[model samples]
Target: MAGMPSAHSSGDSRAPGTERDGGTWVVIPLFNESSVIAGVIEGLLEVVEHVVCVDDGSTDGSAEIAEAAGARVVRHPYNLGQGAALQTGIGYAREQPGAEFIVTFDADGQHRVVDALAMVALAREEDAAIVFGSRFLDDRTRPGLLKKAVLKTAVWVTNLTTGLTLTDAHNGLRVIRIDAARAVNLKQDRMAHATEIVLQLGRTGLPYREFPVEVLYTEYSRAKGQSLLNSINILVDLVIN
Candidate 1:
């Protein structure tokens, strides 16, 4: 698909072409998450319509899976970083025919559709431009000590840089209204773009909220997710940038 697009409406890519009455669009930045991408797409479809997966040059036939499972697939020619994929997805999504809001979701099944819907509803009720899913807002998410420490450190750095006070900086579940989304221009082509997203969105001076969302740290999610080295890389990104 050349165009079109979240409530954490994003997922890792792989699905079929599914359609629905459009209001919100979910953008999933996909890589090699072949096994779980279809499930994520289907789950999101139950709540909202118009799921689009940006396949970040995955080698495991992820784009095909996503298209087959009911999601429009945007394929990268080669392996690009998640930031680039997200930028592309959001950019593409915001241009869709009936788009009103965008959700950035993860493809590994760590994010919940209920949390995404709640965040979207919050945005509508509060007239907020941005709604961020924060695992640290309550006791629902229990990240390991080391992971929490590192993520908390990253939050501090993100707040310092973006001047936006937030409890969780890297939680992938986020709701961005169309105007706020149009203002986003992600330069960080890596996961570091998560912070870049905060910085750019904060500059918009639009209303934002943080809603508590659970992050399921399943064994599979953990294995496919950030490693110690990846965490440190994220930290260094904040420090150096």
Candidate 2:
């Protein structure tokens, strides 16, 4: 774990079960998502008490929009990829006063706001270090044929490499305990970081679970860069690295 600290080591100062509220913070990583980030932030604010948005060197005014929408904004000077953005956001969450749990959400309007409650509740109830949102658990939300094929391949490869049996391995909407996140380091900067996170979690033997999540594949998200090819690139990155 290059980016994450050791789990058994006690680097984080927050004591377990010390916080009274057990508050959760939502972290959204955005890159040139000026059109949709505002709405995502507003929707998340309705449910979560704290929201942090990491602007990954977006040329567009994403940081301004996120700040105006009431999310604490962190900006990367250059495009460091989603993994770096997520790490930055998690670091911010760790610095917050009462951040017991952290949730990663997409700014491209794919994840639903209501799902956060279930993720948080499940983490608390099960004491799971990581709770991933699975779209394939329910067949109704399966993506297109090509996309589905890519996801299935990803699931297989992830299982082979990481030994974690996940129904939806590449889902962005995930809730994780702050301590667990701080423990598992993520070094990959590109899209492959998603797989890297899961792999690291498995290696550390962290407890995890998955729950059904709604997936809304809008034309905007599809057009903005989340294509089936990105999955291939992610795999390539994993292999090459």
Candidate 3:
């Protein structure tokens, strides 16, 4: 909700519902992902018309490449964590006309558009406020043993703390109705935001479901993704903050 006012208060003529039924915006929070963001946006545009990429102060030309790939790029003056970038993109999507739904996607190219489309379709069919993707529910995704163990532990901890029984608490792929989108206020500004989202939903008591989805962990994602130390830090941050 922090960035929602700027979209209108700035006196922009393009109000929310500018696209009517086509108001589904895929929000991708990007870092120094110039190497992969173009292809990511290209694939997302194939399914959804409005793709908002928030560049979290990437030194690389990520914003330019994303804009060239047909994404509306929002830039941060400095490096904010993934959580802050997501909040910015989500707020922008909220102000779009006919923006009925919003999807949180990764710029690492690990997420599949087919999965996102499935979540979007599910959101419409069930009238669910939120639909989250779970890699553990599907057999197609093969995470490394260590990664699997860490994430499984994370899911358990999140469920225990948030009091929600979600199989995949931290999976990035998620779809939410406009109401749920407006209600999600993230403050962690880092990997901790994943947990924060669940916590917020628990407090709001929004309807949520988990759908099985596939994740392709190539060398790039595995190398650039969260590490064991980062995971530990996330737990500490969640507890302290």
Name the candidate that leads on lDDT.
Answer: 1
**Model 3 regions lying over 4 Å from their true place:** 1-21
84-203: candidate 2 lDDT, tens digit per residue: 998888877776665688899998999988787788889889989889899998875858888888888888898899998998878899998877877656788888888898888777
Ranking by TM-score, best first? 3, 1, 2
Query: In angstroms, how far off is 10's CA in candidate 1?
Result: 16
lDDT of 3 by residue, 1-241 (tens): 3122222222222334433225578999999999999999877776566788999999988989988887888999999899999999998888786678899999999999989988988888887888989998868999989989999999999999999898886788999888888888899899999999888867778787889999989899989989888998899879986
Error of 2 at 11 (Å): 30
Alpha carbon deviation, residue 10, candidate 2 (Å): 29
**Segments in model 1 whose C-alpha atoms lie over 4 Å from true places:** 1-21, 238-241
Q: How far out, in Å, is residue 68 in model 1?
A: 0.4
Candidate 1 structure quality by residue, lDDT tens digits, 1-241: 2124333334533334644435788999999999999999899887677788999999999999998888888999998899999999999989877687899999999999989989988998999999999999999999999889988988998999999999998888999999999999998888899999999999999999999999999998989877767867776775685
lDDT of 2 at 51: 78
Candidate 2 positional error at 179, Å: 1.8
Error of 2 at 132 (Å): 0.7
Q: Sort every candidate by lDDT, greatest first.
A: 1, 3, 2
In model 2, how large is the Cα lDDT of residue 219? Answer: 86
For model 2, where is the 10-residue window of minimal lDDT?
Answer: 1-10
Residue 75 displacement in candidate 2 (angstroms) = 0.8
